[model samples]
Target chain A: MDAKRLTLFAGHYGSGKTNIALNWAYRLRDEGRAVTVADLDIVNPYFRTKDAEDDLARRGIGLIVSEYANSNVDLPALPSQIYSLVDDRSTYGVLDIGGDDRGALALGRWVPSIIAEDDYDMLFVVNKARPLTRTVEDTLEVYAEVEAACGLPFTGIVNNTNLGPETTAQTVLASMEYAESVARATGLPLKMTCVDKRLINDFAGQVDSLFPLDILELYYMQKEGM
Target chain B: MGEKVLMKGNEAMAEAAILAGCRHYFGYPITPQTEVAAYMAKKMPKIGGTFLQAESEIAAINMVYGVASTGKPAMTSSSSPGISLKAEGISYLAGADLPGLIVNVQRGGPGLGGIQPSQSDYFFATRGPGHGDFHVLVFAPASVQEMADLTGKAFHLAWKYRMPAMLLADGTLGQMMEPVELPEPHDAFGTDNPWATTGTNMEREHNIVNSLYLSPEELERKNIERFERYKQVEAEECLWEEYLMDDAEICVVSYGITARISKNAIAEARKEGIKVGMIRPITLWPFPNKALAAAADKVDSFLSVELNMGQMVEDIKLAIDCKKPVDFCGRVGGMIPTPDEVLDHIRALAEGGR
Candidate 1:
């Protein structure tokens, strides 16, 4: 897979953008590249990239997030450090934009610099499992809303459909047609299909551009063997 | 049961409410629970339902009151501070013997507290939501599945008892994602409600839905009648889940997100040879006094784990009739106690430490 200098993920709420962005950053880091991941999510009050700050730091990856990221204050304050994502061309930058048009509005401010560089891939991550985006038409509506809000055309589509921890190999396989339909409608390349790392063995020679992810253990406090 | 789907707790509850025949949703957005309002705003209109983003929390709840009076299942959701603003309307719903669903996805609070998960609103919900001698039914869900399942149950029980009900959740449960088998959709509005203020086709007397009583004697009578129904609720509807309670000596009590954390602690404690178990209260208002009372006779001591500063400890003591030594372990103001912290507390209790 060809890696871009700037990889941005944006989609509907709870569409697995944060997980994808984090995994993408880790992949870049593993390739011996200088990677920095930014949390551009201002709409959501929880479950942002900052939640994995220590993990990112341990991997020797840079993180640029809001000052009020994990605070009680739910202000739409973007940190000034985001400027470095564009200014520092030497480092690879991956961004997890917030959900929907309101969340994508934050990307509008950085559009000029990003467009001028022309070295980025803005991927529209779609999840067929989310009730609102189950259909091809619905997914495109969200795609158009996000693109218009951020003032950037999506360069590719990523199929990230899954049922949380219950996601199976069949779930990813079944979502292929939906993902292809979305890509065909938008006239964008189907860059990748995200599969749970546990289910990667099931997709052996059948799938292309498969990005395997270790599912984010969000509910680690939950009792085991339940 | 339908195929399982992944959803955040907030979104699960909103979708569950819709499936349970709720056609009207009135709410103002607040953190940890705004997804409820957002989900409703997008889907309600497409499904021929009413979704109104009222001017304020107070207005939103009053709007729920208006819809519920028509014998239709109506709902409103908010976080800690917003729920406080809706207190008056909640009390009115109880006083008028009207059934409605109120969801409080709690964040830390006294005044505009942080947007982190906390069980600080336990007293606010279990006691009375508004100014009156009444109790609203409260269901605390620990997982995304329960968030959806209890939503349907809350609506059923609220209408069955003709009282307001609350799905009390914390920030962690509201924000976290998990797989859930959603309930099948049903039309709750079509049910026959003899007490509803629906227009009588001149064939029967007009039903008047109200809470105001002019005479003190009449007001006292109404209050007593409401208590009678609450008594029936206590007898028949108390819900709780017991984990590894058999042959246990040290019992742990918790609800909502804290219960999930406590379960992890209990599992570790068991591995280390501690006989600790957990009794998770699904129904907070009913309180599951009988289960605790039964366990109190066997357990040497009790630990009340909470996300607030000992709000539920008082109820734990009352439930067990103060029979055993009840210890309080908690975190307040948006901080959650880790499993290690709870395990450490359990370790201390097993070692005879306070």
Candidate 2:
């Protein structure tokens, strides 16, 4: 397995969080890395990391760390795989956090601890198409809220702007530019750009490497009929 | 199978039961849970389902008792206070060993607790829910999909074990709207129910589904048998999540919404060079205490954060047996502690070397 980066997808509600987060996880899992995902969405009740469990399980991606992972009571926390994999040096884990600034704060407890020594990447996922986030100021306000809540500087930004199936390459590039500007201002890296499953080619001109939509699990489901 | 649609927790759960062949629903309208009754009212007749908005929580629960006795899938839901009123019925369901789906889109409570989401019912749900030596299979959902997914599972578990099963959700999970890919509707259940109060004519002898066994020996036998089932549930069904605790020096323990916040806290703490992690429990009743206990063994400290004041904190202490300093993080009533607030607690815990 390839050595993996500890990538975190952080954002607000309806900000294409689970879509982008799940996409990144799918990318890493398919590239021959021992990648696992944990759903920490105790904030909202929609498409979350755990919603993709049965599908991810087919890709050999560990979706739950709780013995009661399938049950309700959404106590969002780190999974055992995180601790077991922390020292293993072979496993790469992705934690899909909840949406909302409140969710950003929820993430504070884990950030400082995961990278106590090793370097890891925390990507503040941004979607301009979302109503609450229409401009750089709005995104920055979110950034500040999350940073303050989490008690740490956001290290990177992932431009994940897509209006679902209607999104085009132009809008995707524009969003990438916006995220890069924020990254430059904050001194954090402009991490991967999150593109929709149908808009993967739109990033060819602007992004060096844009994470694809859940192509990993999609490919598996198609091939194995799982 | 029907076409796939995007649904919310409250909407999806109501539909899931109908898909599970449960045509009967009884409930009282309450915030966060009003959608369940509304959805049923809108769709029950379309697909030949029974929907009722009872006069009170008591009436709704009794309605459930009537329908559940018929051996078909039956259910009811309410907010915290309404759920409290249904405690009498919940106890009866347990005593009768009758399978039912009782949902609580928990709102904050002591009396009419605020209409916001809260998990303070950890005690009410895990304990008998009312006055009785009984327990219910409680599933706490962190996301909407689980709200739908677990509803189906709750029905199956309820019938499989012949017990009352509750989906303990909070107001947030109930009201939130996220993209949920609903499963296609399936065939109605064909399995025969052995304990339902169906007529004796042409069928087997009458089966009385009630919790009024007053004989001490009979009560003891029934309670003992129920305990065996609970033990099996504890052994086979306890569920939870652990994050970054393997080499974690400090662990943040939380559930539901709070757990999500704590995760971000861990992410932030890690960036600042602290080895903090998280432990979230999915099953509040059949708690994954063993997993948490194991987590405590590895971490130097544990912080139990909740929307209430130290309710779940006590549970954490019991599981780990004071293996480490267990710090409590909370914003009582209806206040949800921000991730930074939780981080501050963790920072203090780490700085203090707990």
Candidate 3:
């Protein structure tokens, strides 16, 4: 994977960054694009990149993580191989970074390569219901904070404010509207609005990007389309 | 007029689901988490949504499985023990890569623990409640407002990754009240979950969601493959909160209710001529280990405080893996320690047992 073909999903806690990354990765891979996933999360355990090991491997996707060590103590830092992999990348590669502005700060180390080579989409996942992020200005402030911390500019916003089982079409639409406002304020493109495939037909024409989540499904779509 | 009142974590989650366009809710009632079901029960029908009070926690989870399998945004809520009951279903969701949300309004304990606020569920949500090789996207909320807001992201992430997502909150956070600016309502009849079992008459083949992988080779490959997706998640999705860690002598690590207490403790310690800092992890799953590690390089020592038996403390030890002493102190079974208590712990740890 050329560092030039980089895909990043980033944002604060509860901002849907992982969700966007997972969906995007599946879509690209499904289109017969070779993808390798390296689980760089040494932070939170619940949803680490290691969590999706099974599904991605079944589709012949490459998976790498800290478990290479038997101590089960890998929490920080990435192998120099990651840099080499980025430097040598040919197809598409997606990286799901941990949340928090500080975590993004690590990206600064790779900014030179990231900016120079990658036509990457640094997607900002936003959940309006999250504290410290409920308004367009709130998102802009966070975007700035992340930009300064990571030393990389974000390219788009993914409106992702929805309630769990209680989430309704109303809530999804509201979230998208808020996302649009944030995108306008931040001048970041509103890349996509993720709606449950269950809500597919209802929201097909409503947003700019129809992120048909369910990673494997998109993989199938991509492969089938190709 | 609809009330624009300050609400607790439970109420906010319920209300946010509505605004996010959820129409079906299946859950069993449990303390410190009843507000979620209560709100759904009271409102789901009026808004033409579905809310079912299942016979047991397991049943509630399975019901959610049935609904979520159709590709709809479905959810269920329970305290620690009850969440344990639903572990099987959570595992299935992960195995099937189903997109769904599970709210864990944590109470105390390894077993029928207290209904009071506690962070004991940290490992359970971070790992899993069942004996399985699986994980969920866990979002830890420090306040009621965050609990409400993260609900949407949970569902969105669940769908995006084709896995289960969790909103891990403590009793204090779930019960606390706070002001919130609600989002706009989605057009209900305008939803688009084609994969949802909204009924597949002549459209396409039926969708089946299951996690029972009989083939060892298949399951092994599945495990490796899921790790691939997780890799992508870690690279781009981890999250956390940093407070005054720049050039500090020692750092205090905490989350949820304890995070609030830790913050206050830091303030007091600062006033007393101590340079203690804080790093609150917003996304517990993406534990913000890198930031903690970096800060550890600049600090003298680290102190970890939680409401459990020093559960998350292990994460701190692993993250920083520093030469400095990584001390820990906490109260369990819903016993919330005061900020002074945390300050005392910090001072004790900082003084190096002198």
B1-354, model 2: which lDDT tens digit per residue?
Answer: 332233546776787787777888999977657778866876788678789888999998888888777887789998888889999998888888878889988877788766667888878888879887888888877766677777888888888777788898876677654445455665334468877777788757778877777798998999999999989988987877778877888888887767777887788889888889887887787888898888876888888888776877778888999788888988766666766888898898889883
Q: Any runs in candidate 2 off by more than 4 Å, and if so which?
A: A1-226, B1-5, B187-190
Location of the lowest summed lDDT over 10 successive residues in candidate 1 chain B? B183-192
| Alpha-carbon TM-score of each model against the true structure | 0.97, 0.62, 0.59
Residues A1-226 of candidate 2 have per-residue lDDT tens digits of: 2323676677755566666666666678778777777666555432345556777788887664444332333344555555554455466777776665666766666666676745566778877765346568777877777777776556777777765434678767767677778778778877677665577764556676576675332222112211
Interface RMSD of 1: 2.2
Q: Which stretches of candidate 1 lie over 4 Å from their true place?
A: A218-226, B188-190
Ranking, lDDT, top scorer first: 1, 2, 3
lDDT of 3 by residue, B197-233 (tens): 6556867887556677789998899889988998777
- Scored by TM-score, the top model is 1
The candidate 2 chain B region of ten consecutive residues with least summed lDDT is B1-10
Tens-digit lDDT track for model 1 on A23-87?
99998999899999999998889777887888999999999999898788999898899998888
- Ten residues in a row with the worst lDDT in model 3 chain B? B186-195
- Tens digits of per-residue lDDT, candidate 1, B73-180, equal 999999999999999999999889999999999999889998999999999999989998999999999999999999999999998999999999998889888888
